[model samples]
Target: MSTTPVSEPMAIDSRSGSAAIIATEPAAQNSNHSCRDADLISKYDVSGPRYTSYPTALQFSETYTEATYRQQAQVNLKQGIAPVSLYVHVPFCQNICYYCACNKIVTADRSVARTYLDYLHKEISLQSELVGKYRPVTQLHLGGGTPTFFDGAELTELMHLLASHYNLSDSEQREYSIEIDPRTVTQDSLALLKGLGFNRLSLGVQDFDEQVQRAINRRQSVAMIKTLTETARLYQFKSVSYDLIYGLPLQTPASLAETLATVIDLSPDRIAFYNYAHLPQRFSSQRAIDRLDLPSAQQKIAMLALIAEQLTAAGYRHIGMDHFVKPQDELARAQQAGKLQRNFQGYSTSLAQDLVGLGVSSISSLHASYAQNERDLDAYYQRLDRGELPISKGVELTVDDQIRRQIIVQLICNLQLSIASIEKQFAIHFSEYFSQELLALQLIENDGLLSCEGDKVIIHERGRPMLRNICMCFDRYLPQGATASFSQTL
Candidate 1:
């Protein structure tokens, strides 16, 4: 949310582009030791913020009004207004995947999607007007309960609508991606997506084991995903990403190994190997999953290690927490060039400083503030029907918030923190400003999880799996025992 620099003193980004932090020679193999440390796993694998945004969305309050959101939208955010990224959250899904924790509506009726698209038109028009209509949209992502829920004609309409409202880029360098459910897309739909200017594909292939699939209520075959992967390449989609999850309802190292073997044969350009967090109380759909069937903590840790070892051996570069990419992928290149940044949508190429999120329950990241649309369907529609922004809650970052945000994002993305660079940028002594937080980190520093010397906080291999716990020390809002709401780090 901290959009701009304070008097140009606070460095804008942690990348080498800014005078903030310099990255160490990052090795994908560094994290192989993380899962091996039983003590390390037991001590630090607790609930905490993922640091996609500092002052995480939990800090968002209703007091932050639509007026404040509008004011910031009109103000050209940090670095003199370059291009912006767009994230459109489609809320409707025909069937529910029990493991999913995203904001979505599950229903058999198809009419709801049509209704949602109509209201999206009004929201898109309003958003384009507030944020500049001419600002080149270099990045566009369609995330959802299921973005592929719409038919070909409906999806074509959505792309056309976005093009009309904003200066959607046709540049080869642009990143236009969508999240797809393997069951929802057809050969024609996949072709239509490529024709519609989406160059990237992120497929949700939670697991390939049919039994595990049935246990989670998502029954897609490895053959189905194989066909889709082949078709994606034939259509010349720039990147194909597969989202795989571990610690599911019915899974073991042997089953996961088979799944990974199938995935490797179908080699996606990028793979996000996620740690499954079963919080049944937080999500009703997950209640269907029997807790007894879930993998043990030790097994989950072994699974994580297996993923890292297997992917790296297969020549995929592990980028940040859960993402693994081919050496030639844009993400790997971005990391090497120090142009990577983490957002609500995992890791990004840092093409734009501001990301505009539209549709119900979507959150937009402006330079100084974060804002969200009405979370409830009725509330969202009623506000839009009255020709108003469907805002609900958000938070504007303070100067202190900005400093900690850079620290967390740097540690998360690059695996190192440059304390001297941060001090120079924010015009404060890092040690003195964060005296208490430093003390909290000392215990872990002694454990050799991280090296917090005079000017650097370098996360070693053992610390990679504990990234959330490391970042949690800097969170002002996340006090002790307040982690009941979050998922485990491992």
Candidate 2:
């Protein structure tokens, strides 16, 4: 890692003591002069899933039904397992960010949000009826298209409706989290959210540079973010996180470095430095961005290295794959204890029995299967109006799917896989069951990305930056020649 000189230390106020600050220098020029000779960018920039979930969302089929989902929920609940987590996806955003590929609907109709909330409540009740009343909810997350798009009262009602059915206790052990757009949040909104039991806030601060923000069509000033962070802290939010992206349009090394310098001064508990993936054909919004404004592959790589160096020097732990957290944050602690987990929400400290998702385009996971709600709002409401569950498509995991999912999750979350543990748990010889995957991993091992000792495969630190590439070796459903179907691994 490269080092940058700090002229002075800046102090940022925190609930605990002050946060340390360190200056960051502009990214050094890429040293890979031979990349052009071998066409390395084209070779390694193949389409791939981010592996947020094993068997990626693409594998979800139309064969599974609502009844199957209910059955699975009941069985899991009856096993007296730990409480499950809940994720509510509010898909409406007022404006479009060109770089975002998340499932979202851009609309300004407030009535649509209201109608959607009604259906969301019904779905919560349906799942509650199946899982029984006493099943405690250990974690609850409200994700976007800007979850804060709803007004204060609307948000409060949604929280109350879910809390009523799921029995959320006012305990610190339970993590209640939400995503917010800094441009949309208000002091009242933050207070309302805090009162409704949301203890964590993740502000979308993709790039502080004005030109970069304009290129992505997401314009929010650094002062706006600072005010929002200050207000969230005043409301006593347990943790504050910021999301930053490299490789976006108009993001030169100097501009991104300046943005990082400003961000470190704010001292969020967690930071996610993500890669901007441009897939115009799949995501129409991205087509609006001028490709010429974007950074090159080498520049993107340099920016990532710069972020790692600056953040590490400022006392943040690189908690694996695109996430950094202060040493005192629960995520960092969980990582140290080997209890960190990765879900659709990125890194988390919660280990719930399962995840129950509500609303259109939401996804749920039980031990036996994974189910998804209807993707279209019209279809979702029609199902609920007919007194039916809103699930349109899902996949019932076979015994093999379950075993493979466990292995993938372990590798992605913990960076280590034990073949013996998998065999003992699933009652199958690891080599016989995963012969093809092992062969693919061997190829990656030859490339110095991983090490295989006996039946165990460990991803080295060098491989950590390319964790997604390693995970793809085990993805069974990735269609052959699916070049334009997914995003870049970097």
Candidate 3:
């Protein structure tokens, strides 16, 4: 129940009025540490989408009309090649956290949530019309501004609306999941979630240290989180994941290590150790944090190394960047078997063909294109009220976009890419078709970040920590001087 705020150093630029920039001293000038050079960071930290989708959401064009999205949905439904995965964004939080960068609005109005729910149901009906009849849903994820912000009745109503239209088969058990705020959940809430068929829960436990918690304006305790975990398990939650952050205000190696040790004791099936990307410009609430109270670059790197070492020692397998799982967890197994896939949601075990996103500001992906709903809440509701799909922008990927995406996904998910395999599958010679991208890889290889053996380009273990940098080689839409769109790759 401790609510004391933790103080930190001043390396983060809080007044930048843009994404908060955490300044890090360039690594020591040595051949082995060349990857940390200023030139390398400057070159790789360019503005590009995180590639959750092939044509990244930023690349989505205004030309994607409602008709286009409906047409695409019809074709995919007719093909019946893969089960659909649905993501619903609930963007209302009772209070704002200084460190939160997610697209959310702070409000205590229950009526707002209720009205949003009604519009969500309308959007669901709109989507159903496009796909026609029921298609078995394989996955359903409810994300942000605290999905539990709505009561159990609202959650059940939303799920029932989806199930009624999509038709979940008995044999096709859905991977129903939701993100829970530790400060918000109660016994009744947990019971309602279980009754509504939510089998997975992801709790946001940034840090257990009271000082750090206060610094970020997110106050919670180890005891409360432990109780929440126990409650979820008691309610038959199949998988529980905890989200942890590194390099936050008032964070130190010892403090973070102690937090991780305690988290391991809770024994959640998965952990996401995300780096604190201090972007105040993109998120105004972050402006409340003092920039002087952040960690140094060297400290940040050490903290990351420490987290990896401790998690690995605790028998958790590192599944690419920022995620770890127990050996029995499906994510780890998928990584080992090369079945891992990345989407708008960081990493996924389900191999659903298309992602249909509902709610304001959500994005969806299909075989040939990517589309995003309008980000403005009023705009989203207006479109739905007008009997529209709320689709504001999208991109139709070319054949080249598809091929490059395949290569990028393999590198990001598996840390290995075979040029010959890519060539054979796409019917294009890698060296000839992607000359510039290959040249970029050569620069990375020369720096010891990657290596080429025969026709395969493999990222070294050291390089694996910087997977985003490696993937930047193939991005076709990297804009010049657009450095503020994404968080740091470190």
Q: Output the number of the TM-score-best candidate.
A: 1
Q: How far is candidate 2 from the true structure (C-alpha RMSD, Å)?
A: 7.7
lDDT-superior candidate, 1 or 3 = 1
Across 250-350, the per-residue lDDT of candidate 1 in tens digits comes to 89999999999988999999988777778888768789989999998889988887887788888888777778889998778777775667776667775
Q: lDDT of each prediction vs. the true structure?
A: 0.79, 0.72, 0.73
Most lDDT-accurate candidate: 1
Locate the minimum summed-lDDT window of 10 residues in model 2: 1-10
User: What does candidate 3's lDDT look like per residue over 104-216, in tens digits?
Assistant: 77898889989999999999888876664366677777886678888877888888888887865444246777888878888678888877777878888888899999999
- Per-prediction TM-score, please? 0.93, 0.89, 0.89
Off by over 4 Å in 2: 1-43, 479-483
Candidate 1: where are CA atoms >4 Å away? 1-32, 77-81
TM-score-best of 2 and 3: 3
Better of 1 and 2 by TM-score: 1
Evaluated against the true structure, the overall lDDT of model 3 is 0.73
